[model samples]
Target: FDLVELHRSNRATPPGIVLDPFAERALSPADRGGDRREPPDETSGATASRGGSGARHDRLVALDCSWETAERLVEDFAGVHRSLPFLVAGNPVSYGTPFRLNTVEAFAGALCILGERDSAERLLSKFTWGHTFLELNEEPLARYADCADSTEVLAVQDDYLAEE
Candidate 1:
């Protein structure tokens, strides 16, 4: 995972799908046409877990700043930006809170929705509380993963929120 310190360089370009709430575009499997490219086989490892179509050469970018500053900072990078579907945060700081993921959690959630389960698991393994996030949001994450577009994602989110 290449961590780009947004404060360090103004020239840094986001590698792949960016997890930005302020993004105008939504990352969806159908948005890229059909999955014409072959996804990496199970034994291929991390490199095979690139989200979205294999055509794009980039990595998933998650801003690590405070939420107050995230909106502004996210505008600085350019790429395919996507907003995460509604789910609860599992980190101690905001346990049970909805839509407030730390960097690792955000990455994992985004990866899972993008059908990169192995990659998501790999990222979550870096943090002790990672598994908790998966457990807490298992249903929402599964629903979000099945969505073909952002509209479907939003619908799922709405249904989940309404249930609360």
Candidate 2:
């Protein structure tokens, strides 16, 4: 289900003992289509889960401090979305791109989180370090900022993922 649907059903509260506001906010109706929109009505399809229950939403969330955590999230997502096609792309641990899977083993083969247009924007929004961290990679930032389109920006994971 989408954000609007979640709030409508009042099932916006996802599973688990705790809730990450970012994740919760992700399901909020206003956040569904983009950063625009004024929330949703009470009975929109966007709020209905595939199961007609909130269980699928519950399973989507996982908090992990280890690789095991990552694996489980992927497993659950794959299990729930077996029918709907999705592109999984991220680091080397998850499956690489250009491949499809109906199980977690696909993750073992290669984990590739496809940075489609929206996903790419989400990544850039979450990963940027602002002006302070920018000092560490002034040259690259200066070079990349000159580009107009987001796709034109080269993403150097090392600069963002590496521990300072």
Candidate 3:
């Protein structure tokens, strides 16, 4: 919940996971050197319930600027980058549009895919239309959550697009 403000010229690497769709890199479990140990069964502990390790400690960073300025803003960043799968926006300004989520919705979607549902819901609850985003993307969110890696996420995203 710590918010660090940075000037556009500042090139210091921000700490933790960064959600940047335009980033050249994509986040994957393999980037963490691969968790070779088998994941516990679904009926087991928090990791099982959450569908993954749920051990992500990097604070997720998101750009709050306009789409036009977003890419330029994060151009110098060198961190773990992840792009959310396709999901429709629920905000009044961008309702029904795909991949145009406001900060809250984007964070929520990212969190959901990371197996952090409670955190996602907490972020979404801040906005009146937040629940709407979740409602509209429930199936895709669930499917994305089940993906083992970014490659799998891309496959699921492709499937969703094909159906659309």
TM-score of each: 0.77, 0.21, 0.74
Which pairs of residues collide in model 3?
none
Ranking by lDDT: 1, 3, 2
lDDT of 1 at 112: 79
TM-score winner between 1 and 3, please give it: 1
Of the two candidates 2 and 3, the one with more favorable TM-score, higher being better, is 3
Candidates sorted on TM-score, descending: 1, 3, 2
| Candidate no. 2 TM-score | 0.21
Candidate 2 vs 3: which has more lDDT = 3
lDDT of each: 0.65, 0.25, 0.62
Residues 1-164, model 1: lDDT tens digits: 44223333324443345677665545554433223342321110012226344443345656667999887676565445567778789999999988788877887887778777777788787778889999999998888888888888888888988997
Task: Residues 1-164, candidate 2: write the lDDT tens digits.
Answer: 12112322213323321112112111211111122223221111111112223333322222222433433332322112211112232333333332222122221111111112232233223432222222333443343334332233323323433433
lDDT of 3 by residue, 51-150 (tens): 2332332445566678897776654444355667788999999999998988778767877776678878876777788899999999998988888788
Residue 160 CA error for candidate 2 (Å)? 28
